[model samples]
Target chain A: MSKEFFTIGALLYKDYDLIDVNATLRLLGSLKDNFNIITITQTGEHVKSYTPQVANYINYNFENCPDFDILFIPGGIGTKYELENPVFLDFIKERAPRVKYVLTVCTGSGLVAKTGLLDGKKATTNKQFWDWMTSNGPNVLWVKKARWVVDGKFYTSSGVSAGMDMALGFISDVFGREAADEIAITAEYEWHDNPHWDPFAERIFGKNI
Target chain B: MSKEFFTIGALLYKDYDLIDVNATLRLLGSLKDNFNIITITQTGEHVKSYTPQVANYINYNFENCPDFDILFIPGGIGTKYELENPVFLDFIKERAPRVKYVLTVCTGSGLVAKTGLLDGKKATTNKQFWDWMTSNGPNVLWVKKARWVVDGKFYTSSGVSAGMDMALGFISDVFGREAADEIAITAEYEWHDNPHWDPFAERIFGKNI
Candidate 1:
């Protein structure tokens, strides 16, 4: 059988901080040879931006994102709003079985928790909001100290900036460490250096008592 | 004769906030039909996680950026550090004359102002840092109230997220408002609701006070 490689679907909605949405889109776009990716908004519109090769975007209702090799969820300030929606959660639960990979970044892990996908599974989110995830899904093993975490098919990552690290890790899993390393080198990012607790965060929040 | 189009360059750095970079990339990427989009990075190596399809990523050197139709500078914490480099400023001064369209967002505008490119031009930066911008670029006409400002070939925007709005406006200038609107609509960005402020500056900061 053919490898049947395919595009990744990034589900988006209102208050979906355009930065995270676009970051994932651009990262996935860079890996075009290995994965076809597009952004699907709540209105079922395939959003197009500066990328023309990505002109023919595929749009879908939040609850109707199509079957794809990977389902990516980027986090933002409005993540709490998504967790409160049963329609969105139900769709996530329904599609969990079809996607080979389920990825969540920043507060996006909360959505997976709402779907019960992370029950008794290891996960992570913005350290500032870990309590919210813990409160919503008590059974999940919350790794607050991690930049990214993996449990079964579910992959979760810390805050907005860490999304790139999580995505690179996913790309590493799918394509190999070398490919991931290549991308990190191109961006001048320390491929594996993830200081989960930023010094600024510690300064602002006061290092865990 | 084909319409004179310019390639806009955005510098992508490691650990840079993914979303901020994406907002600008998406807008520039979408305008490829009318503009050539080139991304210059401090590293020519592989960039994992975020948007990594930088047309030409250079490594640790200011000399690698190509002469473009336009120069786009997106802001983030990266700007905080990049702005401190004198070599980078020299590179900007050397290239500013070759390109007619010079644009920046958030702290990135500070770097532009530092190069004295916007010395006499009207511009803006993140609202929280308006005073800092004025202090840094004493001669520039700092418009603390505008979301995005266009003065001659110099364009600057306020804050990180606002880069997309500036990019859309820039696209409209080159591709017509209709094409820009179509791209925004497909992206589901509400097309008309920009989260930038100009009048708010006068009200909040008191234009004269």
Candidate 2:
């Protein structure tokens, strides 16, 4: 492994979407030779997901976390509750700005939106809960028809499976399109290459915003 | 939930493919009202994935396991080692015959193929490792171009992300298209309705087998 490999810190909390978290990890972990991945939680304890699946232990807590080049956050039914958590918001506020990439999946955008970093930026969230998600960051220009939105360093994706698409895009941005396409082929994933070709957003919002 | 709700026992082992496992869990879990999901391992301990993510704890071990309506087996790099373990093979042999549905994702088809359940039946596996996967169950007619295959009670998907597509197909088979389509709509997933339209298989093996 190279000494300069990128580090990605994934946020973990109770009720975090298991699919969003795992899919992103699987994609990034496949590039393990180039990335050092760590799972971080509020307290570094075992967290229970909405599926009721328990994740054994997190790698770090806010107080002892290392600097990361990327921050990955996943959204779930728990985001509705985590939004009110000052510790969670504080952690995001502190770490997001320092990371080269701030990636969010599903309603995870809602939590990231609370950090104020998304203010005045273009972003998107899980379309199934669009109205509620949009309300979180009123100042942000939310793209209604995007598999994912990339503005500066922030990458926000729509819904659960869409996270995989966003991660592929992120890989393309970081490693080049050929690398991303190669990874997609190895995983046999039909990469939704265009960020704006989201049918879910079209179905939910009536028009692609 | 109904008294007769189907129970899906998902096999969890060290280095299991987290994406394949979690994607299926998320889709079926969304239908939790109609299913009871449980995670099982060899010794019922917390299992670490190839990505080094920790699953808190499994529900049952081989000795005290419950009869399942469906058995979900996810594949990973660990499978290369697990295929040689007699205990793992015996466990699958004991549980698979009694289950109403047997679901295998990615190289998981390789593991299920070892059970001999797929012998004389048509199935598919991860296309990137096609030659190696095909060698596992030579007598089984392997489909080269398939998002998923359904041979009676068995459902085998092409690769990692393809598992999500196969699970949707399984849902459609068991709960009508309306139910499956509704779930797909909620997840904002473009369910590849036709299993035969697998471009990966076409690209790799030439023509749909």
Candidate 3:
């Protein structure tokens, strides 16, 4: 209702990779004037991360989430477990169509794929856990040689640190290249702008799919 | 004292930059088998970050802090306020000399410089806030062209995300380049092994110092 800043719903769960989650948050939050992020979870209670860092509280729960322009899902070791959760899958099923953009980092793409949202889309997941991640979405056109993949409204990135690069890319798409460049410059990050500049994929898989 | 993993005391306070703090934690935590991290704060209370993310609890207070091999300090807008706090400065002054390594990310280097440990020692800080960050330590040799700077046991990085690079550099120095490379490969990160590859310094200042 308030057209102030673009609202982003950052979904968090137990054992979520803290780096992937926080890197995306920090980059998006840096553009606070252009974006307002709310940490969302299945429950509003404390969420513990794979790093064992505990967040005292989350902003919203699944039952009472607000309307958001974008949905940000980050991956962790927990993704293997979360993918099998019916409630989590249902939440993605319900919300994926509502949001204008769907952004997934690391194996978070695997969770999105499980909802069948990424079935016909070009997406990517963390290269480190290539086999486990790729095994989930048989119908998805998985990009093996990408730092990130962009297909329509979906943006999926490679791994833990790659999420920052994808967030910058999303910023460039939504705002402008200049805005994204400024954010990266401010953070002192070398934005690997080329989506296909993924050496990890080649190193691990021996080829870029 | 356990000779197993290197112990790092991660200093925390209100409004500390979540990106800087978490990036360092996630990278270091990935090597948990080789490093034991404890979040230290002024009080044992939950410290809220600039992102408003609350850390559930802190490990130790300043007075009761244990001996650590390395001291980790992160920076945020809170750095502007924390710089003037005598207790914070005193804590740094006391612990810095005792620790084998002092790691400062973003404006955290400015805090370290304030304690005079970095006086006459070469270091760096967040490049976006270059002037203000460098203004504090007149005697410190500041490297304007660096993703991260290493002078003796002190490792200081450029900005929020540059901390990740510095952490990898630290990992390389401590555990060997192979170990750092393995960690980077595992996280699927392009480890910018060369510290001088700082495009931000050149873009912002028109030259690398």
The prediction achieving the highest TM-score against the true structure is: 2
Q: For every candidate, give the share of true A-B contacts it also has.
A: 0.25, 0.59, 0.59
* lDDT string, candidate 3, B1-209, tens digits: 12347788888888888889887777877775777777888877667777635343466898888899889999888898889998998999988889888999999999988878899999988888889999889999999998899999999998888888888888877777887888788777888888888887887889624
lDDT of 3 by residue, A96-199 (tens): 89988999999999999888889988999998888888888889999889999999999999998889889899888777889888888777777899888898
Model 1, residue A66: distance off in Å is 24
| Number of clashes recorded per candidate | 21, 1, 0
What is candidate 2's CAPRI-style docking category based on DockQ?
medium
What is candidate 3's TM-score for chain A?
A: 0.94
For every candidate structure, what is the RMSD over all alpha carbons to the true structure, in angstroms?
Answer: 15.0, 2.3, 2.9
lDDT of model 1 at residue B98?
A: 88
DockQ of predictions, in order shown: 0.12, 0.56, 0.53
* DockQ of candidate model 2: 0.56
Rank list by TM-score: 2, 3, 1
Q: Which candidate's DockQ is highest? A: 2
The digit string of per-residue lDDT tens for model 2 on A1-209 reads 22346788999888887788887778867776777777889888767777745343477898998899989999888898889999999999988878888999999999988778899999999988988988989999998888999999999999988898898898888777887888788777888999988888767667625
The candidate, 1 or 3, that scores higher on DockQ is: 3
CAPRI tier for the interface of model 1: incorrect
lDDT of every model, 2 decimals: 0.63, 0.83, 0.83
